[model samples]
Structures are given as structure tokens and as C-alpha cells.
Target: MTESPLTIPIYDGSLVSVRSTGSSMTKAQLTTGLARRKAEPEPKWKSGELPSKYQCPSCSNYLRFPVQFEDCGHYVCSSCLPDIMRVASRCPTCQVPISKDKLVNDKTLQKDIQSLEVYCTNKDKGCDWDGTLRDFPVHFETCGFISVDCLNGCGAKFEKRFMNKHQKDDCPKRTVSCEFCKTSIIFEDEIPHLNVCTEFKIPCPNQCSTEEYPRGKMQDHLENDCTKQESPCPFNECGCEYRGHRPDIEKHMKEAPGIHLNMAGKTIALQKKLLQLYEERSNEQKNWIEILARKVNGLEKNYGAQYIWKIDHYSERLQEARSNKKTTLFSPPFSTSRHGYRLALSICLCGDGKAKGKNVSLFICICRGDYDSLLTWPFSHRVTFTLLDQCEDPDNRRHITYAVKPNVCKENRPFLGRPITDRNASFGAQKFTDLDAMSTLEYIKDDTIYIKVEIDNEEMVPI
Candidate 1:
């Protein structure tokens, strides 16, 4: 072997005392010796021959950390020394008498064995790595030519380079499951098969105990087959508090008619009286709201009313709304004074009357405030709704203006007003704007839309 010249540093300074330095010294010695030997040029090899001199005489394998007998210079591998001593109290190579107590470590031979350049075992299999015998373990760990078994224990081996691909795409025994439908499948063809796994389990939206019901049958099962579902009784108007599975309730009703009839008569009379009270309260609330609204409007006309209303994530709000045919949202009530009459802006999607579904209906309605007792009676205002244009273009900004007539008719006013009248009223455009108009105008951006409603100072006119 061609060797690199060894360089040693000489210390002229006195050594300082240390509590622990044995580990550092041993590491430094190993590192320096290995580096010197690794710098040597590789040796040429003849067929089936090596330059290792410390070979075991018994099996003829290369000796590592050879042990020498103290009495003689003959050396043998420490691994085989035990077996040799058991057979006879002699060295296998020299037949010299030996014992465990008489054997000493042969450091010189260990250095030679560590310096011998060896080819990787996979060199014949296209690996070209060359390193000292001491480094063979590390080289073998990351060698590309080295074979690895399937992680799933499929008994198939692949080169380290192709092992990942084999497990993810080629290995038939690899365990995999669909992401969307969660059906177990083999890795091979898992992607294509997942797109058509029709029988995958999905949750019943009605939250039935059958958690893994088939996806395609969910609607039908919830509507007709689910036994745990609750429904109103057939004798609903008879003040029955029982809500349970429909079939059992129907059976109970069919068996007892006289009892149910008597219950129904008393139930109707009580319901009528309750309804009448609700109507009366509702009327009082309407009158209170009307009085408060008129007071706020009158104050706004006297002192300028400036308010900005913002509704964000307009699209998400629409999607979350439970009503498929109609839905309405109301703004927080605002007043012209600290405790003056209050009014709120309302928008009904899918409309309420003739303009239903196709248009966005806007309204300004009365809200009862604390200062209603000190306010006026009749409520009226010219309300204007502005659909803000989020885009750079000015043409998209559209305004819907309405002229609201004052409730001078006594029957048309609410009972809560100072001069209490028996009615409820609001002012707005039934078809303020169409859905198509809002979309084409690009009124909503980033899933958000803005609406600006203000009381117009102009005098009210007939509709």
C-alpha cells in the first residue's frame, strides 16, 4: 500500500491537569490513525488472493484484533481463541501452549487489518465503492446496490434506489386506502379504482347510530328506512308532547279515538286563547317599533344621520342559511340619539311576495328603543339602498330609491306609538334588484358584499 506521510504536532507548553480526558485521547488516536491509512493508494489484487497477513489458521478467515500468546509471538483471532483453548491448551497455528490469562492484545496487527483496502461485497453486482476494512459497515449501510426487503414483509427485494417506488406503486402486498372514500385497496391501481368505489361508507347526516351507511342510499335511508328518526304525532293538535317513530305513534292514535277527540277540543280552545294573546303582544310590539322609528326619523331629519353598514363573506352566509327558498338578515338597530327611536335595515333573499327568489328585497323597518315614550306617533321616511361596486368601474354602482308615505291612517299605525294605532308597517322596494343584476354588476368580491342604506332628506311621495 502507498502511504501518506504521518504528521504529529509537538507541544512545547506544559500540559494542564484535567479530571477527564481519556475519551478525548482515544477518539483523537482512532481518527488520526484512520485518516492516515485511508489516504494510501489501493492495492492490486490477484485472483482470489488478498494482502491480509493476520488470517486465522483454523477457518482461514481474516483476523481482526488478533490476540497473541505472552509466552510466544504466534497470533490468532480473539473470536476463535476461545474455541481453540477449549480444544487444547495450545495455539492452533503453532501448537504452543496457551491460556486466557497468557493472551495479550496484538495492537500492531489490528492497525494492519484496519488499513487494508477492501472492495464492497456488492462490487460484482455493479457497486464500485472502495474503502478500508474498518469503513465497510458504513459503506454497506447506504450502498445503492444493496437490496432491501419490502416494508410490508412481502418477501420481495429491491435495490435501495427503487424501494420507495416499489412500496408506493409496484408492491402488490402494500397496504393502502382511498383518501376520499376511505376504502381499503392494494397499492397497485389504487388511484384509478378509488374514483369508482361506489359502495364506500359515509356518515348519515341525520346523525343516526348507523355511522357507516352507504353513500348512495343516504337520502332514501334517512327519509324512509331509518327507524330511530323522530316525527310529530298524528294527533299533533291534541297538545301531545310525544314525538317518536311515526309507526308506533300512529298505532297508539288508532287504538284510542275518544280520548284523543276530548283532548283535541280542549287543545283547540287553549290554542285559540294563546294565539289571541300572541297577536295582541305582536301588535303592541309593532306599535312600539313604529313610534321609535318615527322618532328616530324625525331626529335624523333635524340632525344629520350618518351610518355605514358592512356585511362580509356574503356568499358564505348565503350558503350557510338553512332556507332553500327564502332567507332574511337584519342589521343591528341604530338610532339618531343615545336612547332615541331605533331603525334597522333588512334584506330578504328570494324575496317575500311577487318578486320572490329572482330579486333581492330590501326594507327599512321600526325597532323599539328606550326613548319611544318621549317620541312621535306615525313613522315614515324616504329610504334609499345602495349596492356598493367593489370593482374599479363606476358604472356598476347602482342605487334603489323609494318614497315611503307617512302612516296618517289611525288603523295603519301601531299601538305602542304615543297616539297608539293598531297596525304594523315598513317601507322598501319589494324588488330592489335582481340576482342577475347583482352578479353582473360584480357587487360581491372575495365572497363579500356591501349595502349602504340611508334616510333621504327629500320629502316623502306617494308610491
Candidate 2:
């Protein structure tokens, strides 16, 4: 069967077109009009079926809005009339020539067709309206079972009766007002707007006596108005330990002046004592640092078995020794090997023992070392000492040299044994070099003397 276009008014007061088939309507046909309104089922005729005379000849469907041909009294549905006139200019069944003026609306046949009783289109959907075809269109328009699109543009369809409820309560596009801020907004944006609303009331963050305040004023209230926030006492720097709410703390300050004064006095006394202790500790640390620095310097100097001692300010040292101010001057320490015995050279500028005021005294001392436990006890290495001539010409130089070997016996254990203290007692010649010999040659050139000492590694005792 051919389709017929039907125009209907929707709930939104707008007209939309829908296509109707002969007997039963489809969901697609209904939804295309933006209204899911079905067309009525076939009408119930007294004879059980529509008569053939009232059916269109071209499409074979019952004639709707039937038009009659004046020549043969033949009729076709108005929707199909245009096609017949355009194609053949004659009645489709009789072949009689027909024109637009001769084809007229058959009011009598229309009334007959309208008087046929039919069930409402929404009968399957629980609609009970049953009436003549003439009253069907009016009943369908107001049918509560018919689904229509929401007028709010929310893209929802339901019974025409529920449209009002959907728009007022469920449609996202419906207008709404914020309860707290009293601002108008669409239901779709209501949640997002409420989240950022400045006038929204929030509980006090500090948990003060005040129940709540607007979010916009919360910061100001916390900063200047909260009574439960804890603050330090006014005399906190004077060792006052009290902390309380502003009002309680103010009361404390007014009642505790004598206690605050006592606390101030004790705080000053404690500060003075702390300062004295700090000074003492600082001095001790400084001394320890100086000792560590000297040890580091000694380690740097004693990298090998040989050491070249440069004695500057020789005159001043000699004068100090002669006046009995300082008799001994110690050289930085030296090592027998990279990780072997630690030793140092000491010199008495004026002389000592039998050579007092006659010759300079020189001695060797064994110092405690990190590798002492790994070395052979009672030192046995031979040592050689040389006093550089400091001459401008190397060939013309007369350098004084001496060699010594430790006794390596129990009697010499005090001087040669593994050192128990920072350094063992000194041992060597008391009359090393005479004062007269120093005055001759270039031994004391530029008031600076260079002394070289070498520990013999050739016969070094293996650990």
C-alpha cells in the first residue's frame, strides 16, 4: 500500500508531518514526526471488511479523503489523485478522461467512511478509547497513552500527560534556582553552580563557638574572629610556656605579671650560662681542629723514607735556645715507608747535655702510628743526616753528613719499642755539629738551613 502524509500539532504548539500506512503503523513512522503517536488499526465495518468500491484502485488501500470523478463516479484517495491526473488525465479504473475541476470531494462517501467505528491507535499501549473514525483524530490528539517529545528540549519522550511532570522535575533543561544563593540556573548546571557558590554556608574550620559562616567570609572570620584558635603567651620569648585562646591568654597575662618577671630573670641567667658553656666548647673544638691540622701536615710531609727539613728564622730560633726560652725545635714527622713506622727529628739549636752551648744537638723520636701493630718492634733501620752547604756552586760545597744505627736491644726498648704515647723518648747524638762549623762554609746561608734525613730501606725488616 502507498503511504499518506498526515500533519499533526505537537505539545509544543508546533506542527510536524508523519507518514501513515494502510492498517498498522510502525515505530519509525511515529518517531519521525518527533511524536511517537501510532495510527489507528483497521476500522470495524458492519460487513467485517472494507468494501471494494471504497478502496483506491491504484494502491488498493481504503480511500482516505476520497475524491470523485464526475464522468464515471469513480473515486480515489486524494493523496493518489495528483499522480493519476499527472500521468494519464483519466480515472485509474474506468479510463475516462478527468480534469481537476471535474474531480470533486465526495462529502457523502467521506461521511460514510467517518461513521465507521475504530479502536484508538494506542489500544496496544493500554488506551481504551473506542469511537467512530470521525472522532478518532480528536481523541488521538488528547490521548494520554501517546508519547510526545519534551517541550524543554531535553530529548525525552513519554505520555503527553507526563510532559508537565518531566519538564518540572526531571528535565535537565528545566529552570531552577539555587536554594542557598537564590540564583536562577538550569537544572543541568545546578550542581556545578552550587559547588562554587560564594554565599554557600560552611562550618567553622577552627571549630569555634560560631555555627557557620558564608564561604566568602570564612577566611576573614578565621583570621580575626575565631575565639578557639590557640596563640602563644605574650612573653613566649622569655621562656613562658603558656598557650591558650586569645581571651584566656589575655586573662593569663593580666594575672601573671610577677610570674612573667621571674621567668624573665631565670631566662637571662640560663642564657648567660648557655653562652659560657658554648664558648668553652668552641675553644675545645678549635684546639682539636688545630691538632688535626698539624697531624694532616705531618702526614703530607712524611710520604717517603726521606725528609728535607727547611728551618727558616734560624737566627731567632738559635737566639731563643741560647736565652733558654725554647731549647728544642721539632721537625714535621716522617714515615719509614708509605704505611710503616712514624718518626720525627728534633734539634736543640744551642746544644744539650755534654755539648751544651758548644754544638747543636739532634735526636730521632718514634711516634705512634696507625700501622704500629703490623710492624716489627724495637726499631732497626739505619738513619743518615746531611746538613746542606747551600753553596752557589755545587762542586765547591762542603756538606756535613752523619749516619746512625739503633742498638735494637732491650735496654733501648724505651726509645725503639712500639710507641705507647704520642711519641717515645728522643735518642741520638748530643754533639751533632759544632757552632764554629755552622759559621764556616754556607751551612747557615741566608739565615736558613736545610737538613736532609733518610731512613735506610735496603735492610728494612719485613712485617
Query: Candidate 1 residues 1-463, lDDT tens each?
Result: 1111221111122121122211222212211222233333232232356644656675465654466677776766544554566567687767888655555555567777777778877777788888787787687788887788888777898888788888887888787887756777777668567556666567766566756766667767876767666777667667666677757767777877888888888988998999999999999999999999999767656553434567776776565443653377777877644544577777776565777767888776667666666755565555567777777767755554444544557665652243322223455778888777767656777777777766644453311
Top-lDDT candidate index = 2
Candidate 2 lDDT over residue span 296-317, tens digit each: 7566444587888999999999
Distance (Å) between predicted and true CA of 314, model 2?
99
Q: Pairing residues by index, what is the TM-score of model 1?
A: 0.34
On TM-score, the leading prediction is 2
Clashing pairs in 2: none
Off by over 4 Å in 2: 1-50, 57-62, 88-90, 93-97, 206-210, 227-463
